[model samples]
Target chain A: MTLSKRIIPCLDVTDGRVVKGINFIDLQDAGDPVEIAKNYNEQGADEITFLDITASSDNRDLILDIIESVAKQIFIPLTVGGGVRSVNDVRRLLNAGADKVSINTSAILNPELVKESSARFGSQCIVVAIDAKRVDDHWEVFTHGGRNKTGLDALEWAKKMVDYGAGELLLTSMDRDGTKSGFDLELTQQISDAVEVPIIASGGVGNLKHLVDGVKLGKADAVLAASIFHFGEFSIKDAKEFMKNNNVEVRL
Target chain B: MIAIVDYGMGNLKSVHNAFKFIAPAIDSVVTSDPKVINNADRVVFPGQGAMPDCIREIEERNLKDAIIHAAQSKPFLGICIGLQLLFEKSDEGNIEGLKILKGNVCRFVSSKTEKIKIPHMGWNSVAHHGNHPLWANISNHEKFYFVHSYYVKEANSEIVQGQTEYGQKFTSAVAKDNLFACQFHPEKSGSAGLQLLKNFTSWTC
Candidate 1:
């Protein structure tokens, strides 16, 4: 009767293509967003998240087209993040078939967006993404894709976002972004404890044990990984199997 | 023909697309027109958002009578907020419901020690009651994607077909006559969900 700890495979897309160097040489078109998403779906990944790293508005239509095709084929839940700045962006993505819309910069620039959008579209569909990095004794919230610091405490910002009607929190550690070390367990645990809503630990997941530790130690409801899965280091099945063996319930 | 009643609540694309993926040849349309809902062989009332908002939109569009008629006559399927609306009333906004079933929708409560989160999101297993047609080919305790805060408390226990536990046991799915509803989204629940949707397409009850 317990809820399974989710294992989400995030696809970093730039110019309508997967940005990571995938080692799936067997895949004819490894960088294809739809193909990669479909591959993860078949691998039993709990959910598929698309982080649109494309900054140019000219390529917006490409992502939408990709989302439409993937949503048509994939039966599981789809989450879209990155460059989502307004309610209209959320609408466009959801209409294109995203189950949840994650907001990072917009939410920080205008905190009301989280409240207003969640009011119109249920809170269940509004995910507030917090990019934070440790600053001495406490963690500080960072924005602009973890490039700038906001001087705001990460824990305080998380609780405030929940109050502003964020259903879930996607907590990413800037320090661990491409380090391949593991998740910032202390940060994840603090956010999980600070708020009642579910929090997903992201940024540093080098191996299968990291996934288990993300849930077991960090108390995170889900774990989001990119390069490790993208580089063919390990499959989602291997991660879930390891988690299940370690007594962490997961959807096999 | 299947008419998915879309009353400007949430995205009906995934639900519509799931039907298209299952039986490509079938005529499935997302329509707000009550006439289309009435004429269709089957009706799917799928929605998400606040209960009060859902109620306002359904009434403003003059879909109240149409939805009630469809539920009474044909194989009507209610999903998420749709399922919550079928009950007598809801704790959310203290609003009235469709009253199609003898039940009430109540929010999940948490204590100091056990802080069960609201909007019970993510995958959880369902314990089916018996050999229901919807449960056909699906194993017992199969996991389905769910995301909601409030849950139904059906007065008639016999009508409760499926149950799931979060902080406590709640009715996840219910079936009575031609009416079938669930707290989880079968359209977004992957294979097991697709199987449930396929079952609904051929469901004669």
Candidate 2:
């Protein structure tokens, strides 16, 4: 019963600008991370997740600054992931006021890292993120920013992580990453059904109906998207209203 | 003035923001200080995260007695986890609650439906059960944003002001003399949510 339907907004931070794309292409600057997070906070976003999508060293510093600035202004729970590799990285983010630290590449490289961090900081603070791509009709776990294949089945890895004491699972489908078509329901359902912890479904969110579908059909405890929210195409308020109309319970 | 209890749990800023939007003149502060709670015109308890942690923080800050006193003396508004804590106890943990409202917090039984999910997160319609000032300007069938798996099952149904249907109709809002609560997050709720805050602010009860 720890699972709550979460309406989350994802911010892709690069060089201090919030950027988003389809399949990680056609990159465009959306807005300031601080400004966007503030708006989402005011509009009632359950949580805000920031993904450091940039590779530049300078952008990394900028992302940290963005986190610090946004943390000051926002009061809701804030989660930051991407390019996070060590406990130091996690500590830095937490020191910057991040409520939860999400790990993807590091967890895939050393699955034991999930257990180690969970043991150190408590399970509720550790969020293991998984990126998957369809290979030979089988969902394969990917890492290194979704650019490399791990040759591991997504569901198997998710179950393993839970056994390792990861508190929550953040599952993102590479194929659907930026298409805005909809969430990969089959992938999301597989992880959700396999794991006991809360699952956050990310990738391919187009509109409010897709958000509702993510929770209702995909069985996700929360839905995360970047483009739709950053571009002003859909708002957290309108999205929650649509979910209400459709019978998807959100905190109003 | 509204004293927002700071129990080191989920977002209290958004709750304060909602109050600011609705009643700009309403004073709000996040503090565990008893003197502040005693001085406020009203009280708002908004919760996020776990219930056990919230209860512990309230006790650690020595605000338990103050919260109970405030509930007994002035208007109180509890939202989400805040509402769940008002009950007799919660299955979330073995910790005892404020017992201001008579009920036990239980998990949503979604096994009854194939489509319904737990954590019942999102916006859903609230069906009014009784006339309360908190419902003023809030349509009977209007929607509110909810994000929890557990709800209060009042020992006394008379305290329930609204109910919502997910797998089945459960209490969405409850009211007793000088005390009110909603399982939904009125701050996160949009315009209608703001209206509820406004109504609560202006209510004489």
In model 2 chain A, the worst 10-residue window by lDDT is A21-30
Model 2: CA > 4 A from native = A1-10, A21-30, A33-50, A54-103, A106-128, A160-169, A178-185, A195-201, A204-252, B112-116
lDDT of 1 by residue, A152-220 (tens): 999999999999999999999999988989999999998898888999999888888998999989999
Q: After superposition, how far is residue B93 of candidate 1 from its true place, in Å?
A: 0.2
Q: What DockQ does predicted model 2 obtain?
A: 0.11
Q: Which stretches of candidate 1 lie over 4 Å from their true place?
A: none
TM-score of chain A, every prediction, order shown: 0.97, 0.90
Q: What lDDT score goes with residue B199 in model 2?
A: 88
Native contact fraction, candidates in order: 0.79, 0.05
Model 1, residue A107: distance off in Å is 1.1
Q: How far out, in Å, is residue B156 in model 1?
A: 1.8
